[model samples]
Structures are given as C-alpha cells and as structure tokens.
Target: MADDKETAEALIADFQKSIKDAFAVFDHESNNTVDVREIGTIIRSLGCCPSEGELQEMLAEVEEEEPTGYIQLDKFLPMMTRVLLERKYRPQPEDVILRAFEVLDQTKKGYLTQEELTKYLTEEGEPFTQEEMEEMLSAAVDPEKNVILYKDFVTLMTVEDT
Candidate 1:
C-alpha cells in the first residue's frame, strides 16, 4: 500500500511537471496560459501526431469557461495527457485490461471517477471485496479529482502484473 501510494504520488508529480514544461513553451505572452491556437503546436512538440481538427476538438472539450479561447494549465493538462496516453498505448489484442477500461470510460472521457468504476465493479462485473476495492481505488484514484486517469489506470494494471 505504501509503495502504491508513493508510485501514484510520483506519477502525478511527473505528470504535473511535464504539463508545466510544455505549457511554458507556448505561453510566450507569459500570462500563465495559452490560446487555443497553440494547442496543436504543443501537441506536436510532445511528439504526438494529432490533426489540427483533433486539437480543436480537444480544446472544445475543456470544461472551464474560457471566453477568450485561452486556457490555463489545469484545463489543458487533462486533454494533453489523454492525447499522449492514446498515442503511447494502443488498444492491442494483448491488452485485455484495456477492454475493461473501455467499458468504464463509456463516454470516452479517458478518465473515470471512483463512482463510475465502483458502479461497474460492484454490480455488473466481477465482484471485489470491500478492502480490495478500497486498495485499488487508493492506488489508482487521483487525490485532486477523485478520479482515475486512464494513464494511471494503465500503470496500475501493468504494475499489478509484475
């Protein structure tokens, strides 16, 4: 449990740092934010091949109220993380765990809240002990959002196998 918590914390810290570094590049105006137009460039700089249209769509999905089309780091991080994860981890046949994730992330949101995951696990899917569920949630759930990032979920699954 300690190891899992440490791993989760490290992963989150790394994620935050990566987003900060990337956002700094396009935040040339130094307002600690980037315009929607620069998102494509940022994605490209991250070594991900997303189309202009795709980048536009992701910007549209930002949940915050950005009247000027300028998004802060918090709003931009999730979309960037999702794009990078999708690029890095393809849904191959060998990745059976991904099938389970797809079922939970029904909206294709690339993340799942604890409620969403617990609902499936408790009702329709394989049964888990209360302690087991708690442990999984502790290891994978993001403390800030109380949700599981798809990338973190993947890491949790991968780590469990080893």
Candidate 2:
C-alpha cells in the first residue's frame, strides 16, 4: 500500500492539480476548512460512497480523541487520497467492506483477529447483530489463525449473493 505522501502525489498527478482544489470546493466559507455539513458532499464528489453515519465515523477516526467536525485541506487531501486509491485498486465491494476495518487497524498489521473484528462490527455507527457478525466472521476468518486478512475479507465480500 502507498504511504500518505505517495498516495497524495498520485492523486495530484492524476488530477493535474493539488488535492487542495478538491477541498476548496467544499470550503465555501473560505475559512480554509470544510465543516461537517459539507464533508459528505465533498467526499461524494471525489467518488466515495460513505453513508452519513459512516462519514461521521470516518471523521471521528481522523480526528481521533479530538473529534473535530470539520476537515482542513491538509487532512482532507490525505483522506481523499486513501479513498481514491482504495477504489482504484481494491475490488469495490471489498473496498466498501474493508474501510471501517482499515480505519480500526491503525497498527497496519493488515489483518484483524476475531476479537478485533467483533469490536469493529459492534461499533456505534452501524453495529452488526451477533448472528450477522458471526456469519461474516465464519466466512472470512481463518479457522486456524482466527484472523481475517484483508484479502480474505475482500474475497468473502465479493462473493455473489445467492
């Protein structure tokens, strides 16, 4: 996976301008930051599909303990870069399903243990039911290791609905 600087540069090269230009579209007040109200519109315009609630979770993740409601251009650029790259490289369904886990896996281990997976599924934004969570766990987790690698998660998520 590309580091933030590499991803930002790639997005800038692809767009032929700084990612700040994209942020400016949402920075209507010209305070150099976009408030929560415009974050979804901005992200959508950049080709992401985070729900309102999910967007809130993303913002919280970015802000961490600070919990800022707005995103500055600097912050938004990196976030957008990651989103674009994930869409560009990861299979779409897998990208969608892995986003929250990616955020939760801040250690960059690229895998989540069953316990970690359980915590994410039960997070406040869109908590999963026990059965749904267990079903997903059974499908994606390695039985021996009791962990879900992102590759496995993607494979499980992209399976055709029966």
Candidate 3:
C-alpha cells in the first residue's frame, strides 16, 4: 500500500516536472508567465491526469505489481512542447473560421444546408436558429457563390468592441 502511494506520488511529480520544463521552454521562447491553471488545463486537454477513482485504482495496481523504474521524462517532453506550440501559435481568425467551415463541409459539397449548419454550431456550443444561420450565410456568401470563404466569414462574425 505504501509502495502504491509512493508510485502515484512519483507519477504526479514526473508529470508536474514535465509541465514545468515545457513552461520553461515557452518562457525562454516568449516572455510570459505560465500559470499553474494553464498547466492543469493542458494536462486535462492531453488526457494524461487520471480522475480520483482512476488514480486510486492505479495506486492499488502499483502495489500489486513490481516497481517499474520511474517513467522517462524525455518521452513526455515532446508532447508537452507540441501542446504549448499549438496553444501559443493558434490559427488566425480567418484561418480558424475557414477551417470551421471546411470541417462542416467535410463532404466538400460546396454548400451546407440549414440543418447541417445548425448541427455544426450546436456541436461547437454556439447554437443558432435556422433563420439566424441563413442571415449569416446570406451575408457571407460570395456573389459567385463558391461557398462563404474564410475571410468573409471572419469579417462577418468578428466584432470590434468599442
């Protein structure tokens, strides 16, 4: 039981250390404070940290099993670096909107019906009525009608707060 607890503590420590190392890289590359919450968020996003119950189960398992040497820190460092890069250098507004539209139109059908638009929006937690969607789509659709490309979609949706 004590062994199990030790294993769990060691695992958590290693994970935290990797996070600190990743933050150090980020700090050196771009002068910014990497808050603990950000580390937790990234850990959660990566699906690494187990839930309370899962952690308990792992502890029990570790007690039963022979001790494997401590987890290699290098294996996780690259993944941490990748996550930092993704969050730090996110896509531009136009690129993001364009990718959203492209993803919604995954079939490459060149157009999305009202229902499809609503489904995509709902999945993104940005639900809109058919009428509201039509209004946005109508405004965004180009004259030639080659779908509402990314730039136009960004222009229509992004608001400048006064």
Among these predicted structures, which one has the highest TM-score? 1
Candidate 2 per-residue lDDT, tens place, 1-162, comes to 469889877665775344566678778798878776677666665556676576777676555356567777766666667667566322256566677678878998989888887887788657888987988888888777778897676766564421
Against the reference, the lDDT scores of all candidates come to 0.70, 0.69, 0.52
Off by over 4 Å in 3: 1-92, 109-111, 122-124, 142-151, 159-162
Error of 1 at 151 (Å): 32
Q: Sort the predicted structures by TM-score, highest score first.
A: 1, 2, 3
Candidate number with greatest lDDT: 1
Cα error of candidate 2 at position 51, Å: 2.4
- Per-residue lDDT, model 2, residue 91, is 29
Clashing pairs in 3: none
Report model 2's TM-score to 2 decimal places: 0.42
RMSD of each: 17.1, 12.4, 15.2
- Measured with C-alpha atoms, the lDDT of residue 112 in candidate 1 is 88
Give residue 129's error in model 2 in angstroms.
23
Q: Where does the lowest 10-residue lDDT sum fall in candidate 1?
A: 85-94
- Residue 135 miss distance in model 3 (angstroms): 2.9
Write candidate 1's Cα lDDT for 1-162 as tens digits.
999999977876676677779889989888879877677667666665444455567777873563676888877787677655455422233266776687768799889888878777777645666886898898889888878986666755552210
